[model samples]
Target: MLVQVNFLGEASGCYSGGMQSQSSQSNKARRRKEGLPAITPEAICDAAISLTKEKGLEGWSMRDLAAELDAYVRVIYYHVGDRDAVTSLVIERVLSEVAIPSAASGWRAWFDDLLRGLRDVMRRYPGVAKRFALVGPGGHAARAIAETGISLLREAGFGELSVPAFSLLLEQTCQFVAQEDDRDALPSLRKSAASEYAACAGVPGGMGDLSKSVAHATTSESSLRRYYDDSFDFFLRTVLDGLEVRLSNMRG
Candidate 1:
């Protein structure tokens, strides 16, 4: 299979050379201020994470992050390609914080704790869930989480070949909660969507009632906090019960 190449695009061999000639030195010189803290990739990642926490994935920009770090936008660019690059690093930092338990609590308990812990982290950081919505097991932290989940399922007698598939399902479920983990915007959205859906009901069937679904989402913080808490118990149990049934049938 042949792949199309764009000479003018980011992946081109000369891209770095062109960029260096244009602004590399100037960008470095701008950050050469006295008494200012050093700007390293790790520091940038930390600052990016903090900025995301204050606003959100979409809430913060490269310029916002630069301002936060007391550096120029080009300085940020020098470190990372763009806002997406910063967010990717931020996601890595977020996922790395999750530690797999040293002992097993059985598959169900393990997954429940794992999922809850991940959601808790996302809620604390604000934009992490949104950033990792499409982050599919690329980085080590995320891959390790998936691997841990897969191994637990295998030990629980799930189909050996099925672990990776199940990991995707688990990730999707986690992403669902994480994406909706928007503590700031979701409450007002919940209220507005409910009202809008109510008004739209009994009207002509023009567009689909999308807000109808959004309205079903819990509005209160307590409810959102329990979005996984109360319901995931039901969900996790249901899955385990079904799997046990499957395992028993296969045994017979």
Candidate 2:
């Protein structure tokens, strides 16, 4: 009788300890809830976009996102595969916001509008432009934008050269503005550019004086943005003019 009483007490103590442990570990990692409003891929993407907008693409992690969703990190994986998957979704979301203008006023006007719209979208997303430039959009929106851009080139008499033309324009515009979204990076970049230019100035066998001067001018945030925008516009117009030159050569 004494042994049985002791056994019951020990068993009760073990049960109590186990329950306490489970309760304490309830919110760790893959903690499932009863009704989570049906976590969809779209829902996961939305949360991820929101998070990236608040924190730069590199700032947030899977665990951080899961915490924001009040779910386990595993739940996010189930919906969106992984961090790259989330980034792809964000890129698609950002691209979808850019309006594809019709060639209403002419191909040049349309192209101008398209680039302006793209710049506006990239500026709105801050650090997103950098990520997009690095990742190079693997989503459907990327395909659509490329197709539309190539069609514009075709309209402008790019004919056989449309493919290369579209490629240059797309890469140049994204890379140019992507560098501009980096507000934090600009100040340091400016200082570095000034120092480097000063070091290189009038130094034989160095970057020519004019190139160094231009580099120095591009360091400050405001100057950097203006320089980027001016350079991008010049590049766009030059490429468009080249397409015309290509057409002329073909005709000749």
Candidate 3:
């Protein structure tokens, strides 16, 4: 089960800073006169998420977030501390949307559902998938997913290897999604790579069966989205099959 985050709603409770400074008071007064709603930490995070959706997580800055909210840059700091803090919130918010599968679905099926959903969600917010691949999922939103995944692995006889198995599954999946995001950002590079591979395949006696293996992938008839989807599906199935073999060996 996952905890749902409020993306657009105001958070409850007073600001934890104890009391507002004179400048903070003046800022609030100006906002009142200008008919702007009071800013909250949640609101600041919401704006950051929107900016990330448009310009990617790495492409936007605190200045851009401030401009989006029509507030001073310090206002973003006063509410959410800094860009890092806001980034954490944005990641949490994005991850909260990941669909968790039922334990009754069995271990392999459960992970298949979870990873597919995760790929779709993470792909919507560029660079966030790479962060997950590098640092792992660090926020509250990812806790339930980890817990359930490990429990299923243990039940499936991973023994002391449960943690490592889960880590490998997630890390590899996120890396694939991150690579897709990067490849998508550079269409020309992808086209160039395809062309070069096609040329390599055309060389007489150079590539043998390997060229035949790559011929379908190099075809320009398929849409880019279709190519990515087909490739991701193949990769997912292969990884799951490999894990199943590993599980068999462990049992033996």
**By TM-score, who's the top model here?**
3
Query: What is the C-alpha lDDT profile of model 3 across 1-252, one tens digit per residue?
Result: 112223333222244453445667888999999999888887887888888888788989888999888888876666666566677888888888998999998899999999999999999899898988888767465788999999999999988988998998898889998998898788787778776666677666857455654555556546556777888899888988988898999999
The alpha-carbon RMSD values of the candidates against the true structure, listed in the order shown, are 7.2, 12.8, 5.1
| Model 1: ten consecutive residues of lowest lDDT | 1-10
Q: Model 2 over residues 1-252: C-alpha lDDT tens digits?
A: 011111111111122345444543564323345554555567776777788777766778889888777776755554456676677777778888999887567666777788778988877666677776665776465787787777777876778888887766677777777676664446776577677777666666547676566665665657756776777788778866776687778767
Model 1 clash pairs are none
Residue-level lDDT of model 1, residues 158-181, one tens digit each, is 776456546555665556556566
lDDT, each prediction: 0.63, 0.67, 0.80
Better of 2 and 3 by TM-score: 3
Model 3 regions lying over 4 Å from their true place:
1-20, 205-222
Query: Candidate 2 local accuracy as lDDT?
Result: 0.67
TM-score for each model: 0.70, 0.69, 0.85
Assess candidate 2 and give its TM-score to the true structure. 0.69
Please give the RMSD of candidate 1 to the true structure: 7.2
Top candidate when judged by lDDT against the true structure: 3
